[model samples]
Target chain A: MFFIGWLVIIKNQKGKSWIKLVESKEIIEIFFHGRGGQTAITASQLLAEMAYEKGFIDTIAIPIIGAERRGAPIMAFTKISEKKQIRTYDSVKEPDYMIIFDTSLLDIPRIKDTIKEGVIIIANSPIPIDTTDFPDNVKIYIVDATGICIKREFMHSSGPILNIPMLGAFGKVTGYYDLEIMEKVLKKEFGEKKVEKNMIVATDAYESVKEV
Target chain B: MSKARKDFTQEQETKIIKGNVSAAYAAKSARVQVIGAYPITPQTTVVEKLSEFVDSGSMPGTQYIKVESEHSAMASMVGASMTGTRTFTATSGQGLFYMNEMLHWATGTRLPIVTAIASRGPAPPWNIWADFTDVISQRDTGWMCSFCATHQEIYDEILMSYKVCEDYEILLPKFVAYGGFILSHTSKPVIIEDQEAVDNYLPPLPDEKGWPHIFMDPERPMMFGNLIMPSGFYSEFRLKIHDAHMKAKEKIKNAAKEFEKSFGRNYGNGLTQQYKMNDAEVGMLIYGDLALQMEEAVDLVREEGYKVGMVKLRYFRPFPVEDIINIAKSVKVLGVMDRATAFGSPTGGPVSSEVKTAIEGVEKTAKILPMIGGLGGREVTLEQQTEQLKILIKMNETGDAPGDLFHGTLWHGKLEVE
Candidate 1:
């Protein structure tokens, strides 16, 4: 809901910092909704890292930590700014983008209420979601993040490790960070050993994501 | 058998980290000799990260002891500090309350043990969230207390705390507190300064001779903190503690200045930092996480034609009396906000009470407004803060107060329970 119009200093393929003034540096707040064990918390952090890696001046990852159990609803938010320092630890009220890790969470009243006007939704569902009651200008993108994870056997003890693929799909939709940045961030966070498997699901979700 | 220690080559890098992790990294950067750890929410990650660093040999030769309770944690740090080593510990809420007895002991014994408090609301209703009452209640403990409004400040202030606390003149323990969950759990980009730079900024570890006041050599026997009679010099020692704190104000300022010079991050004059206070009619004094959020509120309201400003109270113990007086003189109405409770106090908030005391009898100062909000992790949104600013401006204009004032103090954002 805030405006952040500024330049982005991303590194070129030649390994030099290339400062490019973004024409539409539209401000974006990413609201992440998922159940516990779905890795939505990690997804928010990964998104912030990818954005910062691709040269956003300020970023904050806020996970609403409270009585979280394996199947209970969990929420997080990532605020990315190019021109201004992102202050305020408060959760995003009107999100420009909502990354829904579980499609069923859409049925929850609180989650449904958050799908405000002019918002773009990136949902992890194999099929299109019902957007009949959504506010005007609400755009929905679909990616089979769990399917990709299951096909690649990329999962933790609880369930699918969906954050990587979801973020990959996010990169495709938003053009914030590409697979190269994702690979680099993944390598840094999970170390080199786990990067290969992570990128498998990540590349799948990135290529297969489509607007609905 | 001690395993071969890995040679750590710590390079400065800017990474997104939580406030607790920043504290841990600061302790590592300062090369603390001893760490006594007891896990509690919010503050748990601090010692957890340090333990990881010690285990990985990144913090080589650091003695990390896992104690049973928060009391023993402080007790062990006190014992470790007696040996003239730089000691560190962390706790929150009840964990801090349990260390009350030893907290007084740490200050009384004149040990420079620095502890980080991820401030949380004291529980009867079982709350583990951001509140300053945990550290503010330790007021009479004689230990210096500071608040960090940002994650990076957690790192910077911990390093500065050591410099000020370990000074030969001010050998007093201190607490560096930040809002739990709000600052503690949230992630932000914090620059972990180069080890060499941190080493240069902090005081060198104490020599084998120990502190000048007390020596623990078997040949030179000495007794400390024994029973003192009514005529004993206990009162004088207490007075000296007060003197040391008053003297530390200058040292804290110098340390902040030097830190800014070395690291390129400025934290006001070390005690309080004001934003857009010059040529302002109304101002808000805030601390912890709320202070940073209030800045955005100030900006939003400013764009809408209100000339409001804010001052962040960085240090609470040495009260920043002069800074408070100067700020009061600059504005017509100064609103002091607290994220902590002082149940029976005149203003119903800790910092508000102190601000009143600081500016008492000061001619032509601003009228005081005490406010308490965001306790127990309740969100203080930008919208609400903006509204608060408008209220302050109205107060300055017509001496009007918010209708929600509970006994002359604004209790903002209390939901209807019925």
Candidate 2:
């Protein structure tokens, strides 16, 4: 009887640890691939802020540091979790979601090879991507963020400020955050004067984003 | 120099800010009188935020001096600190190396100046990444050095530092350091305490008498750090500085207790924080940002039925010898992990070497494993930490060291080179 009770205790302990692991493993790891001055790094931070505002308990945005020039490919990451604190500072190697600011970057082997099976890709392109080369379980979504940025005249010196629209389409695709949380975080970060134009691009991308 | 006493009656607010910004907020909350500014990557944002605070008139009557070099930054801070006002500055990597000259001056003069260091790796390879070698290299500079593992600690430690440094018995400058980019760039939610609470906790700003020993009054004027003959009190002054640092251990513990009483946060006796060590046969001793992550590793390892625990060495200067010996008694195997190198030293790692020296004369049963990793901002993942704990457990059970023991140290996480 004592051995049977001990086995039951060990089973209960194992069950609890397994549940804790699973709950902590629900963290959403996202990778952003963009050219320099495309606002991808800022988008990583803004996404963490948005998720936190939307009630995620823990979030971290990591921007890769390097000597980046205009049009040079750069990468950033955001890890958002609801329960556990994000402890690791390493870059996301197996991202659950990938965001591409420029569709042409898809040609880069380094960026292309990172998209694995069961991963979702959100691209800022006018039309859908040709996913014939991608794995069967991979899903790709496209939104004309540049068109929306131009329509709303939301641009900086280099190019369209694609972070808001990209983040908007991301919110639509993942349902992790919504328009309300975006507006709340944007108003806090970018101030009231710039919120109108930002929301214009953000809403357009939200409504137009479609899975290919 | 004569300005009204600012009534900082604002309510405390919690913000999700980067660790560098948290350092800026701590300075602002302390109402520091003089700030020496120089910009360097990672450490740049800290001075930038403080400049914003000064420019917006939010921090009234604060003199923000723009310096051309890190040397001038520390020199100007020394000038201001001599005038009996609270002074603060920050630097990183090459900038810290540049300020090494004044680092000695601040301690020799015995001013209670507080400087935050977003620690980065030494160069020659031109890298600006998280490594503690920049600050640890200054171990002989006579400044009390403390490592912070969390964003909130970055703020709280600075506040407590001023409290301990300004004590009449312990008028010593201190460096509060954290991993560059790891803590400096990462954003986390931190609670900024109300100004009233801070004012009650910290000692009042120094007056015309300046420090207890030195005075900067022009009328009763005096020259400081003047030329001392070799046969003079130079050695005596050095011995005095050493003595003060040795006595600061008690003052730090008292300040930490008072801070917890006032701010309601515990820092584990202000020297070392133990996690899950109640019934552990093996444990790891680490510091800086890695220590926080090690807590998660300890929890995961304990769930696997291994009695694994961790101890975070907070203060490196005072060495925490008593705490080290006490913690050494609890576990059979202890791993001393350093994120900085002390190349050519006994253990090749600064903290582990110190730990070995700390336990030399003590009667202890624990076998010490000296380990080093995360240099030059190398990534130390949670999975790797779990595996490290398993290695410690294996070594304890088998009475054999793990593989890749280079010169009596396990340099974990090195890339496979042909």
Candidate 3:
């Protein structure tokens, strides 16, 4: 069973490592902008909740905008720290990292506000973007995640399943949580074989960032 | 290279593909009992795939419904979803527009159904491609819209969407878009996760007993869509959908999170998708295929030393009014791009329509220009987009409106009336 394997991974890896951290570097806020069915808010909550179970302290996931009607832009956020209390229930103001489920959103306003200094930006676009004009402090990472995902044939119709690889890279770079922790959760959630594929993408993203 | 590695397990490879087709397979795999379909380009492939599944017996215990029109398709799903059966439906372009009336009924009654929509431009000569105007045009309809940027997102979203829509807190219906050409014609390897993985990701519906909890009791019988007097009619009707909509926001979020915990993939929450705008001075707002082009266009401008960004309106219905206002507040100028035109208006574009409304409440003056492009599947070029960006940036610096209806294609050289 996928769930059983996941539990084993979680138990064997850290037993209960993610128990809310007392305090960490800073709060990592990531904003997902996609339609109702796209799993915008769910992505944050699932990552946060599962991490919470592992013992990560002050981890929170919440959606900041819109009614959950289909075809609307749903915004969900995740915050992790070692601190005991995360006072704010509000949405992310200056996200340390931002993921663009739709590259087209690069044209929309305010998506820019989510990014802060040294933010890692991932987008699902077909072509590579020239981020030369980006602020000196900001590091832009643009991937044809959709194009690459399609090429890999790992994508399904409803939406991009690329988030796994995206998350894989996110976990590797940020150390927000252990990649093994994610691997364990994924195995528990997705099963062993699926978890293996996700790990590959995650590792690929992790390696790709170093070249940049 | 120090740590030992496991042999990689590759994702499944498939033949030709489209986002709608992926969505269809998801619904079929989810064991949807009834699929109500109305033919429309882009969206047509989803129903076609489902029919194939039903014909091939790949999906057991499923009824493939071929409805007369989009309206009937929605009407059918509304009835089917209300009757405690997992239901599915799809439409696009004018087909979705035609289904407008039924959409209201589905959400008003709090039906937890799922529909796949292809965002295509509206009619005149009748061309088939993708555009967000069709979906964005219906921003007030009350359904939760999920825009799929890639086929994988489309697949995961379809399953997750069902879970979210069915939440008792969010009894409203959901609309999932495959983003026309970007996803519809695109083919790639899709990791067909074990059926059990999907099962674990999405739990059984809460109303397992049967059907949604509607006020339908044939014994004593209650009125459904009967005439309402001016006394308390609007308020009663308004509050019901309003309560459902608000509850749906939280419900959908929780359900999405649950799906994420079960599945390794997750979609974040928001009324819209935000791209690189943290340090941007000007923002471009768009949807569907056009948004894809604009995304590239912004990068081109960034190369030219302009701080440009974008937001794709994924959730069209229950328009993210406050979110838009907040987005608008951060920027000096905003370029609202609409593939469909609403004639005789100040901006003459669907995107400009609501954006103008949202900007009105803000303090700073946002130079809002409504530019209509890519009508009837007309190819919008990068150069034209670059020109629009130049104008938008200028407007951002100096609040002046340069009245231009269509920026690219044949409209560029044509003289405009003062």
DockQ of each: 0.33, 0.29, 0.02
Q: Which candidate is the best by DockQ?
A: 1
- Write down the worst ten-residue block by lDDT for model 2 chain B: B1-10
Tens-digit lDDT string for candidate 2 (B164-192): 99987888999999999888987777889
The backbone clash count of each candidate, in order, is 0, 0, 88
**Candidate 1 vs candidate 3, lDDT winner:** 1
The candidates, ranked best first by DockQ, are 1, 2, 3
- Give all candidates' CA lDDT scores: 0.88, 0.88, 0.64
Positional deviation of residue B326's Cα in model 3 after best superposition, in angstroms: 2.3
Instruction: Estimate, for each residue in B1-418, the C-alpha lDDT of model 3 and write its tens digit.
Output: 1111111122333322346668887886566778897777767778888898888777766777888888999899887766566788888888888899999898777787888877776776565666666776676788887676556667777887787677665677888875564456444224455566665665555443443356344554445666668895778777877777766566555666776676655555545667677888998887654555566567657866799988877555556677688788888877777666666655667657768876785687466766676665455554456567777787766676665445321133222359
For B45-103, candidate 1 gives per-residue lDDT tens digits of 99999999999878877899999999999999988887777899999999999999999
- Evaluated on chain B only, what is the TM-score of candidate 2? 0.98
Worst 10 residues of 1 chain A by lDDT: A7-16
Q: Which fraction of the native contacts appears in each prediction?
A: 0.62, 0.33, 0.00
- Cα displacement (Å) at residue B28, model 2: 0.9
- For candidate 3, the clash count comes to 88
Off by over 4 Å in 2: A1-24, B1-9
